[model samples]
Target chain A: MDINWQFIISTLPLYQKAAWITIKLGFWGTLLSLVIGLVCSIILYFRIKVLKELVEIYVELSRNTPLLIQLFFLYFGLTKLGITMSETTCAIIGLAFLGGSYMSEAFRSGIEAVSKTQIESGLSIGLSQMQLIRYVILPQAFAVTMPSLAANCIFLFKETSIVGAIAIAELMHVTQDVIGMYYQTFESLFMLVAAYLIIILPLSFLLTWLERKVRYAEFGN
Target chain B: MQNLGINVLFEGTTLQRLFEGLMMTAGIAFISIIIGSFLGIGMGLLRTSKSRIVQFICRLYLEVFRIIPILVWLFIVYFGVTNALDIHLDGEVVAVIVFSLWGAAEMGDIVRGALESLPKHQVESGKAIGLSFWGLYRYVLIPQAVRRMLPGAINLSTRMVKTTSLVVMIGVIDVVKVGQQIIERSIIKVPTASFWVYGLIFILYFIICYPLSKLSKKLEAKWEN
Candidate 1:
């Protein structure tokens, strides 16, 4: 079959709009996940009593299930209970729910890697607890966390594709729409792949660069 | 309006249909894992080859999978390639092909990491014993790498299982799709059927994945020493 350039060109506007929606979902999802991750990691790191166990359970539940089922439950399941949310809200919440667990694990590992000696040294140098966290602990932990954080960011962005199942017109949803309408399956699929590559490939490279730039001085070559 | 909360699950043929769907999901994951493991081992071995060109090709294969979502790959194969080639392929077959390719790429990296992590001394010792290259790999290298590959392999299997849920999108009547069908049929009699149906699916996935993840963790802890 011949490639249909005209069909692709005609659908370019729809693709652009869908791409923008995907970007918005990814952006909000990433931001919310980062916040939830940071908060949960801090709670677990300090071993907050009941909350620690609760966060652990939440992380396990979120991570063990697929994002697709989670979206279904959030979007379809909750509506029956009168807990209604927009499709966008459901998508963002589902992404964050999955991403938060992975991110917290990354953060937790980063925090654990900052040896006790560094914190002690900061304390001995007459630094207050807050000062020690800001000046010493935060820098080392952030450096170690950058690589995994970047990876989680990519994972979450790709996961936004699943949101299409809930009727959100993200990239995959629109591709399906076009395919079903005009039977231009090849062209539509080509555009779908191109859209993902355009978005993810650059982010991946930039993240790798950022990870390298943030490497702690002591983590030598 | 009739209120059927958890009872929606027990409606006619609902449980049985879900059971069949669950089997399909498991079957797909199991077949892909087996095929993917064999192919991944080969790819992993090549990744460690001395030739730069072979390494570059393997890296390219790995990155292509990593860079694109599995959902897009599904569409490209099931909808795009089949139409372009004028071939009729079953949705489950398409899902298996796509997932096996993905699983192989992930498993290849795990195998490569396990093989490379073996100390350089292991190889030198094998060489000193008059063992040929293949002999060293067979007798010394692969045996040790198998242990190191176990936890990672189990983890990847769990990941593959969870990811197989996406197969429903390509029209494979997996568990999620079955649940959606049940909800659509029962919506009038049980307006809350979706909640019960989807909630059960969530639990079903958890039941399948939770133990695999726990076992992976257990093995990692046991083998760490």
Candidate 2:
């Protein structure tokens, strides 16, 4: 079958819009997950009484199950309970919750990597617990966890594609729409793959460089 | 509980259908993992090649597959390539091919990391002992790397199992699809059938994956020790 280069070319705006939606989902999802992860990690680190167990259960369930199922559970399952939300809202919430589970683990390890002496020294210097965490532990923990966090972000970005399954019209969904419209599956799918590569390849390189910078800073380089 | 809904999963034929779907999921994951291991091992070995161009090409393959979502890859393979080639492949076959592509990329990275993390002296010692390349890898490098590769490979297998859920999007009547069908059919009888159906799926997956993940963690801890 001959490829329709022109059709693919004309659909650039559609692809761009879908790519933007994907980026928006990924950006907001990462931010939300980061917040949730940080809080969960801190609670677990301190071994907060009942909350720690609850967080562990959440993390395990999220990590163990497929993201598709989680998305479906929220989208279809919740609707059955008479709680309704837009597909985009559900997608963002599901992605964040999924990302949060993995991110919390990364954060926990990062926090653990901070030496005990550092915390004790901060306390000896009359830093309040909150101030000690803010001034001392968090910066170092952030550096240590930066690489894992970046990796998680990339994973979350790819995962945003699943939103397409629930009809959210993200990049993958839009590609499906274009394919349905033009019946030019090869060109449309090729373009979709290229769009993702264009975004991910450079972002990965940048993240690697940023990780190195963080490592250097941590080592006093 | 009655107000919630009847558990369609326990109804006649429904459980069997779900089990068949579960089997399909497992079968696809197993085959894909096997195929991916071979491809991944080859790519991983090539990644450490002395030639820059070969390494670059392998890295490109790894990165492209790694970066693109499996769902997209599934569409490309199932919808795009099949239509372009005018070939009719079964959904299960397509699922295997797409998942193997993903598994290979992941496994390649794992293998490359395992090999690279070994001390240089190990290779040097093998060479010093006059072992050929095959002999060196068989007798020296592989045995050490296998231990390192086990946890990652098993972890990838579990991931592949989880990811096979996406095949439903490609029209595979896997567990998720079967659950969707059940919900669609039972919606009139039980408005909340989705919760029961999907909740069962979630538990079924948890039963399979939770143990594998636990095993992976155990192996990782053992390796660290």
Candidate 3:
């Protein structure tokens, strides 16, 4: 194979920095998605008639639309409204929003998995609504959400590559820039693939760790 | 651009644009299912093979295909992976290849699930009737398994159509890309109504996918009966 060992060696540090950006966006995106999703899913779990329908519509619309369109729309549309920032932040925010929408459904399903009997049990305790959810409910729901959230994290990590279109200095963006500068298009992209592997392979192991730790009746061993 | 009532839906050449994209989308969706189904059946059975090595390969195929997001997969196949493999191919060809692999994995799992859902008694009776393996599958097993698999397979097909939009990221110019291009054009010509273009896209996707989603749900209910 015709390889460029020298170029990769020289750019390894730059790639490392880019990797940091990728990791940060993915981690933050997953966090935001989980938090926001969990909050919105309360309406769905409570089955609050009109609110449930509205959240369902929100979830479906978000799921059906592609992340890229949403990114571009928010990017350009917000800029026109005088909201501007570094492209990296904008891209990460977009990733978070998109991932958050999907995460809502995940949380909703997880909450529903908690069994209505648990709700009756909580009511039997005569605890306040807020106290019941805090003490009796959310812990079990979060446990069930682990395996799914793992799969989603890996996907979100790869999705950071889309930010390259908007010229963020992440791995994929640097990849394209490197190719353009050196004209070693294939080599640059191959390096990016290897870069992705280095980034994701560790996270995959971590996911397995979390999933195993959660080890409940519902999820896999 | 033409205007009709308060509903800007069917007006201007928007209907024509949507029609063209809808046909392409449906054409790809239907064709991919036909292709993915056969491949999925083979892979699904291959996964159930007694040989450990064959099972390992099936698992590896599913893992790699599943872990990577479809958009990234499309980019790599159409651009990076193809370049590395040194195979020159068009965007659509690459899209179909990647999508088929994805569809195959999902379909294979669905096939496996449906096959497993069947009771052992039915198979035992087929064997008691002195039917051969192929005879049992062709006459008894496949029909019932196919019924159970229909809803999921159709749902996956609808998903395949929705996912065809990812082809646009690699520059295939499907409905989404065409919408983006039109929006850009409209931005220059008529800056007053950008929402119209996005709303058009949302409607177009609905027109294409909503019916499929409903049909799949209906098929599921019917199959259950």
User: Per-prediction DockQ, in order?
Assistant: 0.85, 0.80, 0.28
Q: Write the per-residue lDDT of candidate 1 for residues A32-62, one digit (tens) a residue.
A: 9989998898888779999999999998898
What TM-score does chain B of candidate 3 reach? 0.87
Q: What is the TM-score of each candidate against the true structure?
A: 0.97, 0.96, 0.85
TM-score, cand. 1: 0.97
**Residue A84 in candidate 2, Cα distance off native in Å:** 1.4
What are the chain A TM-scores for all the models, listed individually? 0.96, 0.95, 0.90
List chain B TM-scores, each candidate.
Answer: 0.97, 0.96, 0.87
Error of 1 at A144 (Å): 0.9
Candidate 2 residue pairs in clash (backbone atoms < 3 Å): none
**lDDT of the candidates, in the order given:** 0.91, 0.89, 0.73
Q: Write down the RMSD of candidate 3 (Cα, Å).
A: 3.8
Which of candidates 2 and 3 reaches a greater TM-score? 2
For model 2, residues B99-197, the per-residue Cα lDDT tens digits are 887788889889989999888999999999999999999999989998998999999998899999899988888999888888898888888888778
Q: Rank the candidates by TM-score, best first.
A: 1, 2, 3
Best candidate per TM-score, number?
A: 1
- The positional error of residue B136 in candidate 2, measured at the CA in angstroms, is 1.1
By summed lDDT, the worst window of 10 consecutive residues in model 2 chain B runs over B1-10
